[model samples]
Target chain A: MKHIKGIFAVIAIVMLSAFTTVSSGYKIGDIATDFKLKSSDGTSVSLSDYKDAKGFIVIFTCNTCPYSVAYEDRIVALDKKYKGKGYPVIAIMPNNPDVQPQDNMEAMIQRAKSKGFTFPYLMDEGQKISPQYGATKTPEVYVLQKTSKGNQVKYIGAIDDNYQDASAVKSKYVENAVDALLSGQQIKEPQTRAIGCSIKL
Target chain B: MELYFYTMRIVCLLLLILTASCKNESRQNEKAVDLDYNEDFSTVPLEIYDFEGLKPFLKTNTDKTYVVNFWATWCAPCIKELPYFEQLNAAYSDKNVEVILVSLDFPKKYDSHLKPFIKKNNLKSKVVALDDNDSNTWIPAINPDWSGAIPATLIFNKEKRQFYEKTFTYEELETEIKQFLN
Candidate 1:
């Protein structure tokens, strides 16, 4: 009886440890809650600050993701192209520092400087802000438009069609969504499947 | 009678020790197996290429429903839904469904990271390295609307294609596959 009890105790310990590692999944059509983060230049920024703005482009990105790096120029271009039109871009780094230390604030600043990123690249400290947005991948794009209901998610998906070969791209998703919103028309494909490196939880 | 009791007690203690040793050895073996399969492709350089090579694989097979899942070693949601895909593969083995795991891991990590990960997971489905470097060309061809996110899955029959950008449970994946099958 004592031996059986001891064995059961060890098994229970292992099962309990396993439960602590499990993570909850994100869903679609979820509202992106507001979050505060430190910018690459050490300034604090918040999603609520952009509430009165025309629209917002919340891009979950990082320093080391090749897919995110590929869209660096495009992200910069999108900010420049749309900021005047009232849709400023906000880049958020969503990776856990314990797993991806390069995504920390100091490295974020260096990457932004080297890549000439004009927009604010903020660090999602404690990694709480991203999961709320249902952002699971780096380079995931979320287009938010102010509605009577609140800040509604207009579009979510890949930045474009091609990441490795630019010449063969058949569609420009981010640009198209922004264009549709700017034209005061509803975006036909508001949500799209984005492919990139998974954010470390 | 005292001597007999003492001998029996020693025998029981020896048996207990033997059983414990065997359990420890098996646990170690399991750990080694797991270690052998875990691949970390975070630092590898990406292989850059066009989509021309994937043309043959892109064509839909008439009778079978193809499930193309795009994932990487680093994505959390991708890892979360991996078991569902594996379960789908197991459940639909008799059906005309093929689950393809396309690793978007950097090309440099192919041998060391991606391959080991596939093997460690005991993945039974086909795995391919998407060597495309530029997202501009590849994303549009796959779908004009995709904003490159990991944990994305594409289900295609010759006549229809369905794409999902969120993580799935086994039931959800199986339901989508069934729809394609029907």
Candidate 2:
């Protein structure tokens, strides 16, 4: 009876520890897992494909998310501004069609064309890729830097400090990270809380 | 003396049993109260169709720090990080931290799924439905680079607004909120 009670106590402790560990999610310094997703143009784009680039921006966004839509121009601008600088932005639509049909491929194609997106707006079908990047929301920015070890995530957070009044913006997080990487400097703010629509699992 | 000892043991056992039963009863009562609260709030569907209507609901009080969280009923990461927002709201109750939960659940499932989920979680933040249909106009308004995703959260303090598109642990969330609050 004592042995049984001891086993039960041990099991409870193990379960509690397991729960605590599972609750604490991703962090900076984690290597970004590669994924192959189809772009709006139906071409497959993978993170590994951009291996030659100095850094990569993996943004989990979708067609229907207003927040994602809001960042459309900025994302395009980021792609245009940084792609040449070797920090190309890769946009991924992580919404599930079963829940949000409007976010499907047809809408994605239209949205990309309307926005004149220079970056690859990849469709994360089966919703498999977003979680791998620990992407929780649309417009979530993951800045990756290639080191000797591999593609290490440098900064993960918001684009800029202001969405409403851009003129009074204090911090340009995305730009700063890119600039730091370009100048061969370390990112000061390594991680940030991403704000946007929760990715439909 | 043996008889007295037996009586003492019996009395102790009865006290233990009585206390155990009382604790169980209190737990059951607490669960019942929670169920009643859930029932009261569960029926109200997270309104997800009125984008224009929601604009007015969005507190334009730029003086306060607005923490808007975009979550859906289905996202696991959203579920994981929601408690931190609740805690943040509670901690910063004295401050201008207004924690808003924007449900991104589909319009059709708002009533059946979203409301119950929110209620079950006992979310303490202000809940709203962002009913914007067209992503083009709305997304740019929110942020230019956003590729619509869920579990997104925005922290706005009139002069400064921060957009995050990633899941956060409590420490990270607190750090961001503290930055805004400070």
Candidate 3:
């Protein structure tokens, strides 16, 4: 009976590890593959479209989430400040249209227009991109830099330390990563986490 | 005759002061009763905390099972699963189980959003507000499996601790609780 229990324990451990590996998304330094997703402006947007760009600020955001709404201005500010420095923002709406009607293509277009977004608000149809990046929440960020290997994910997580008050934010995680890349310096903090609404199925 | 009249005057003043104090006490008691009946029962004062202050809630070090739920007013899924947790809290009081709802609402929205929400839902479980700015530090500390998603839960006792980054129905929650029910 003891030998049988040991065998069962090994099986359980192996299955748990396998499950974790299947669920985890991209890690830092992983090469992110490009996607040609549809944007709110009736245009196809892809990472490779920006030829002169050094990196991309790929953020997974949606319209309905209050957390996402709070960060819209900050995300816009990131694009405005960093776009001129070769890191343009590429925001994706990854929630299922069925679960979140507010995040549909029509709402995405209206939100982008009203907010004067200086970036493309693309819809991740079929919700494919977020899972690849292992993004589980709205307002999650991934900063990728173009390299000889491909677009290398330099940073993954929140925009800053404080989600509620941007001014009160101490560590600008995404900004610091992009700035380091521009100055040819190694990024200090490569990953961060923030509370956000789960991507609706 | 002069001494007698002075004593009478002093007695009158004392009576007046005593009646005035009596009226004030009754009035204050009336207001307290009114507040209890008033439909405005949302006066549940929240226990606000930063990351350091919030850490103790997780490590209660008691024999009773602790069901700590991380939720926000804005999270739809979290809101949906709340009633189950509330039911478990109410039904399992004698079973040595406790449920705590940790609100992750923004500090700015505490007055306008979180408080009103607690009142409207009539949440029976003890609700506390976690307004910590450093989420990156605390999110992983809660559980490495947590992807900073709402509707997450932590169940623990003296022997074992388990965290879930997903929603649960009453049956599902009770099943997990039963494991610690020795």
Candidate 4:
């Protein structure tokens, strides 16, 4: 009887904690759940598939958002710079095609082709994955660092300080975090904010 | 020495007169624009703002209530619910209520997209472009619970404050306004 009661208590605590994590969104240092979303190339990809990667730059971006458009080239550049360094960029379009026709898979393919994107631009089908990560807008970022337990969210928020003109940017938050992680140092600033188009549901 | 001082003073006086005339000309130009806006509200240019620039709109010292909404031209839900805000603005104007539409339109598209959309829709609410790129800072500053989503609204008066991150129908928006009014 005592053993059964202890097991029930443990189950209840685990369930409660799982519910809380889902509702609160992915915070810094939290273990992020791996998702197998369809890439723009018509093939499904998962974070766990990247065996040699030290970390992943999971970006919630889309085709129609002007803010996303602004960062498209920069995102490509980030992938070029960091993919070989073991932190490849994974772009996800989180908006529902029914609500945002412009963000449809066809558009994603066209954008990827035109931009010469080396990174995988995945579609978050049914809008299932973004809410779990708590992505509010297009171009939001979550830097996940690999650990023995799992991939932990190391940083969250915008790519850089300036979204208008990249050359004039004084602070590159994403680069700073990835570089710190590469050097096996703690991220100095793990979070930032940038104006972006809201994810259409 | 006397002649030199007298010449300098006259030059100074002429410079002052020239400066005042320029100032008056600019003021007249501004007044003319204001008059034009009052006569035809459609041509009013949307003002650009950053997070700090948008602070005054967040909090008010007056008895009047403000319904400030963050939106973009491309956001489907924002477009769908904008009519409710327009109706609320018209219905509650006499009650000292105001609506401020904050556009997060990409800066590059302000002329190509945002301006044309406003003209086409005939948006009556005071629309302003929020050009701040660092949203992680301001989104939470606007409301701690805000996930930086659009179609988000902040309704407030002198005493109470309410923030909503969901799309609202006409009835739902009206009810929220009424709650603040009462």
Candidate 5:
């Protein structure tokens, strides 16, 4: 009876730890895991493909999220401004199409075309990518800096201080992080928070 | 006679100010209740709240445990898990649990989309609209772990506070409530 109780306790502890690892995902300074996902252009995209990229602005955004829609133009603008500067914006659609039918591949392609996106808008089908980065919401960003070992996440959070209005945005978070890396300066603010639609699991 | 005249003028001035203040107070009270009283019973009262307005609703001084669920009309998972919240509210009415549905629906959609959705669903729990334009500040203030995800729930009383960023089944929600209740 005592041995059975000990076995149960051990099982419970292991289960609890596993659950925690799954739930509480990546934090600041953690190395981001690479993923190969289908882009809206029908090509598979991965961070490793960007050979010249000093870093990547990996944004998990979708067509259906109001917050994502609000930031779409800004995302495009960011990619245009920074792609040549060695940091390219890679937008990922992290929502499940079954839960959000409007966020499917067809819709993603349409949205990208409509918005004139310069970035590769990837679709994270089955949501295999966002979880590793700890992305819980649409328009969430993980600014990764390429190091000798791997890509270490320098910052994580919103694109800017304002998601409602692009013109009204006072702070551009992704821009700041990328600029800091380009200039070999420390990122003053490593993280920010925003309200966005939860990535449909 | 002069003193009497002066006193009468002062009294008249005071009375006028008093009446004006009273009228303003009543108008404000009427405006506050108008949404609830004027609307149909099926249509839930939806008030826009900033972080300041939303703060008190999170951590309450009262004994009632508030199960505040952040949701939107467009969010499918939120819609899926809403019935569970409604059921919990219904079942635990006698208990100290209070359910509040905070809708993060767009301001423009309040009339065209959200109001109608609430009416169509006949959401029984207290519903409010959070219209904070700057999400960067309030998301972390609400809970450090929250990524500003919808279908997220904050269950709290005076003693304990728990924030969940994942969707809930009816049973899962009940178990969470039971854990907090204990």
Candidate 6:
């Protein structure tokens, strides 16, 4: 009876852990945690860096993914449009250089410089931050609204409906979410999805 | 004569899948931008689809177990695991296990890049492209858990269905698919 009970307990524990591990990342209205990561410009950046900010456009993107590259210009435009409106774009490279050397910090610096990015392109060293937000792909967006509670994950997903061509885009999920925050209105689309390269660990 | 008929039937089924992928004009035009693709793939009959067109493949009401793997030419990890899916298809096709390689390569690369990669690899499994731009809609429709990342997979039969958002080894895939087998 003791041996049977011991076996059952171990099985239950294993099954419980297996179930918990899959249900990670943030959901809508969830209070997001903050992190201080190194930026391409050699300065440390965090969500709290912007004191007068209303919210943030947190994008988990990398230099290597074509999808990320395709959205690079649009991302820059987003920063230009919203930074003055109290919402700034904070780009994070979540891929490990070991897996994809193109995503190394030096390349990140080069990419940001060449693109004339007006945002902080930070590297998520040790990959501690992406998992917390549950970002699975490059160019994944999390629009976080700063509140009395903490930074709230307001909207999550793609930059727009048309990733192939910026001109053809109909819906810009990140922009819409941030705009909603600025207007003191509820975000219509709290979450969305877009095809992106799997984050290289 | 029986063996010949069986082979013919298999060939016809393959043909049907190819033809079913013919363009859905209305939906295609809405998402079509100014980008152009090379029509150099005269030999490669790879069917390109929006998520709406690709939906039927995911919900096949068949007796055979189906393994649909989402991959792309640019994704290194997806390419690394392509052979495993091919191997699974070869090893289990006779056992009523079918593998479908769903390529999520960009629409611009469908003809220029994906076709060459398929030919170079000499892929045996049925290959198709999901060219859907409205990913936010279809991504969750395929699986609410899927974060719209490539190399995700779906294995199903009439009795059970499973979706994986992780890389798979051949043995690991075999082990998972075996549970649905007799």
Best by DockQ: 6
The TM-score between candidate 5 and the true structure equals 0.80
Q: What range of 10 consecutive residues in model 4 chain A has the weakest lDDT sum?
A: A15-24
What docking grade does candidate 1 earn? incorrect
DockQ of candidate 1 is: 0.13
- lDDT by residue (tens digit), candidate 3, B62-137: 7788999998877777777889999999999888889999999877767767777787778889999998888899
lDDT for each of the candidates? 0.70, 0.69, 0.82, 0.80, 0.79, 0.82
Clashing residue pairs in candidate 6 are: none
lDDT per residue (tens digit) for residues A1-201 in model 1: 555555556556544553454322222344556677899988899867865587789899998777788789888988999888888999999887667767777899899999998889998888887766756668888888766666678787777776655566677888899889889887776766646666766
Q: Could you give candidate 2's per-residue lDDT for residues B75-149 as a string of tens digits?
A: 555676778889988988788788888876656556666677676777778888765544434554665434355
Of models 2 and 5, which has the larger TM-score?
A: 5
Per model, the share of native interface contacts recovered reads 0.30, 0.14, 0.51, 0.33, 0.48, 0.48
The chain A TM-scores for the candidates, taken one by one, are: 0.82, 0.86, 0.90, 0.89, 0.89, 0.90
Tens-digit lDDT track of model 1 for B1-182: 55555655655544433332221100000001122434364443333334677655566758778888888775555666778888888788789788888877766557776766765676888777777655555766776434465667788878888766556778878777888777
Relative to the unseen true structure, what is the C-alpha lDDT of residue A187 in candidate 5, on a scale of 0 to 100?
A: 92
Number of residue pairs clashing in candidate 1, backbone atoms closer than 3 angstroms, sequence gap of 3 or more or interchain: 27
Q: lDDT score, residue A28, model 5?
A: 71
Model 3 Cα lDDT, one tens digit per residue, A1-201 = 555455556556555544444445677889998999999999999999999999999999999888899999999999999999999999999888877777899999999999999999999999888877878888999999999999999999999988778888899999999999999999999989889888775
Query: Which model scores highest in lDDT?
Result: 3
TM-scores for all predictions: 0.56, 0.52, 0.84, 0.80, 0.80, 0.84
Question: What DockQ does each prediction reach against the true complex?
Answer: 0.13, 0.08, 0.19, 0.14, 0.19, 0.22
TM-score: model 4 vs. ground truth = 0.80
Considering summed lDDT, which 10 consecutive residues are worst modelled in model 1 chain A?
A21-30
Runs with alpha carbons beyond 4 Å of true place in candidate 1: A1-31, B1-101, B105-127, B130-182
Is candidate 4 or 6 superior in TM-score? 6
